[model samples]
Target chain A: AQSVAQPEDQVNVAEGNPLTVKCTYSVSGNPYLFWYVQYPNRGLQFLLKYITGDNLVKGSYGFEAEFNKSQTSFHLKKPSALVSDSALYFCAVTSGAGSYQLTFGKGTKLSVIP
Target chain B: DTAVSQTPKYLVTQMGNDKSIKCEQNLGHDTMYWYKQDSKKFLKIMFSYNNKELIINETVPNRFSPKSPDKAHLNLHINSLELGDSAVYFCASSQTTGGSQPQHFGDGTRLSIL
Candidate 1:
């Protein structure tokens, strides 16, 4: 079975400061990781994904994630945070070989303070 | 033009009532999925259909049934709705099951049981 763990229930960062949301995964085969953001009362919006190739993957709205194969982790990062970036962030993983079902984390609530 | 859309944005009903949530996608994708988001912001996949055929069913209760009329539509029907069934239901579509294809999501239908 594949699973994802987002250790932090909430992450706080000041405006214009860098922010990171940690995520780790456990899967049998190669992992296909993804990040998604959800605003209040809105559906999840895809941010980025890490399949193969480069470890650093850039995504929408100036967000990026680094896939650390050695650590089995994929953390979402933003160079500078904005107040509008406050939302719920979810990290998901799926097996590349079988069972394309996405397993999502508990979600990290990001609060960007101005 | 919404890529993915769900009807009945807010549903409020009493226990034992039956309700249905409808979803449609115009992205010309071959795969569609239904997900449930709990109050704690935990997401779990309920069902997935590829080319109008059932592909993934994630141990959901028999009270919840999903029907795909065509490639563009997938509807969920719940019988004997209970208080525990209240949650935000999301509809998503992807170009395909595997690979790097990102899933597009609808705004979601918030179900409230009283």
Candidate 2:
């Protein structure tokens, strides 16, 4: 089964400063990685995904993630942080073959302070 | 327009009661999924349906059953609800069977068992 890990439980950053949420995955084959954000009392919204091709994948809300095959990491990154970006973030992965069900991380609570 | 929607945004019921959460997708995706988010904010896949057929059924309790009448809808029916069943239930849909495409999610149904 594919699995994802978010090492940090919370990440605090200042507004306008670049922020990052770390994510790693363990899968048998080429992994399909994804990043999602969840606001308070809401469902998780899809942010971006990495299937193949470019290592740097840009997504919604001016967020991007880099897929590192050697490091086995898919970290979410934003050049500038905003208070609105403060929310729970999750990393997910699915194996290349077999079940397409995504395995998600525990989630990281991001707090962007002004 | 909302791509995915779920009925009863909030559900409050006593233990031993039964409840059902309805989900529908307007994106015309062939695959639909049910996910459970615990208090700790851990998201896990509960079930998945492809073309109205049960495709992925996780280790969810037998009391929880999913029904898919068509490709556009997948509803979750929980029997004899327990306190442990209290959590946020989310419905999502994707265009492809594989994990290449990012899944779109609904707001979610927050079930509170008392």
Candidate 3:
């Protein structure tokens, strides 16, 4: 079975500081990973996806994620945190062997304090 | 333009009542899906339709029925609303059912059962 794990329930960072939201996964085969962000009372917006490419993937809103196959991790990152970036982040994974539905993590709430 | 849209952003009804949430995607995708987010914010795939055919059906109860009139539209109908059904329902679409196609999600509908 494919699964995703988000270790942090919440991540706090100061404005203009670098931020990271941790994510890990367990899958039997090659994994297609994705990152999504959700604001309060809103649906999720796709941030980026890693579908067999360079380790570093850039996404919307100045966000990026590093895909580490050895570490089994795909952590979301931002060079400089913005208050507008504060939202719930979800890490999802799907197996390359015909698993079309995404296995999402519980999500990590990111708070950028001004 | 909204790539994916869902109707009734907020719905409040009594137990035993029936309700439906409409969803449409303008991205010309071939696959549509329904997901439920529980109080703990755990997102789970409920059903999926590809080219108006049932593709993925999770372990959801039969009370939750998803209808896809066409490739661009998918709607969810609940037979009998229950308190446990009070949560956010999201409609999503993808270019195809499998492979690395990314799914686009709607704003979601908050359903409350009194």
Candidate 4:
């Protein structure tokens, strides 16, 4: 079975400061990781994904994630945070060999202070 | 235009009542999915259909059934709705069932049990 863990329930960062949301995964085969953001009363919007090739993957809204194969972790990062970036972030993972089912973490609430 | 859309954005009903949430995707994708987001912001996949065929079904109760009339539409029907069924349901679509293709999502339908 594949699973994802987001250790932090909430993360706070000041505006214009860098922010990171940690994510770790456990999967049998290769991991296909993804990050999504959800605003209030809205569905999750795809941020980025890490499949193969480069470890650093860039995504929408100036967000990026690094896939560390040695550590089995894929953490989302942003160079500079904005107040509008405050929302719920989710990390999901799926195995390359299994059915198309994504296992998601509980979610991390990001609060960007101005 | 909206790529993915769901009807009945907000649903409020008493226990034991039956309700249905409809979803449609205009992205010309072959795969569609239904997900439930609980109060704690935990997301879990309920069902997925590829080319109008059932592909993935989680451990959801029999009371919840999903039907795909065509490639673009996937509707969810719940019988004997309970308090535990109250959550935000999201519809999503992807180009295919496998690989690193990112899935697009609809706004979501918030269900409330009275």
Q: lDDT for every model?
A: 0.95, 0.93, 0.93, 0.95
What does DockQ give for each predicted structure? 0.71, 0.73, 0.70, 0.71
Q: Report lDDT (Cα) of residue A87, candidate 1.
A: 99
Interface RMSD, one decimal, each candidate: 1.5, 1.4, 1.4, 1.5
Cα lDDT for residue A56, candidate 2: 100
Q: Deviation in angstroms for B62 in model 1? A: 0.6
Q: Candidates 2 and 4: which is better by TM-score?
A: 4
Q: Is the docking of candidate 2 incorrect, acceptable, medium or high quality?
A: medium
lDDT of 1 by residue, B18-41 (tens): 999999999999999999999998
- The predicted structure with the larger lDDT, 3 or 4, is 4
Lowest lDDT block of 10, candidate 3 chain A? A94-103
Candidate 4 Cα misplacement greater than 4 A, ranges: none
TM-score of each: 0.98, 0.97, 0.97, 0.98
Instruction: Tell me the tens digit of each residue's lDDT in model 2 across B12-54.
Output: 9999998999999999899999999888988888999999999
TM-score of chain A of 3: 0.97
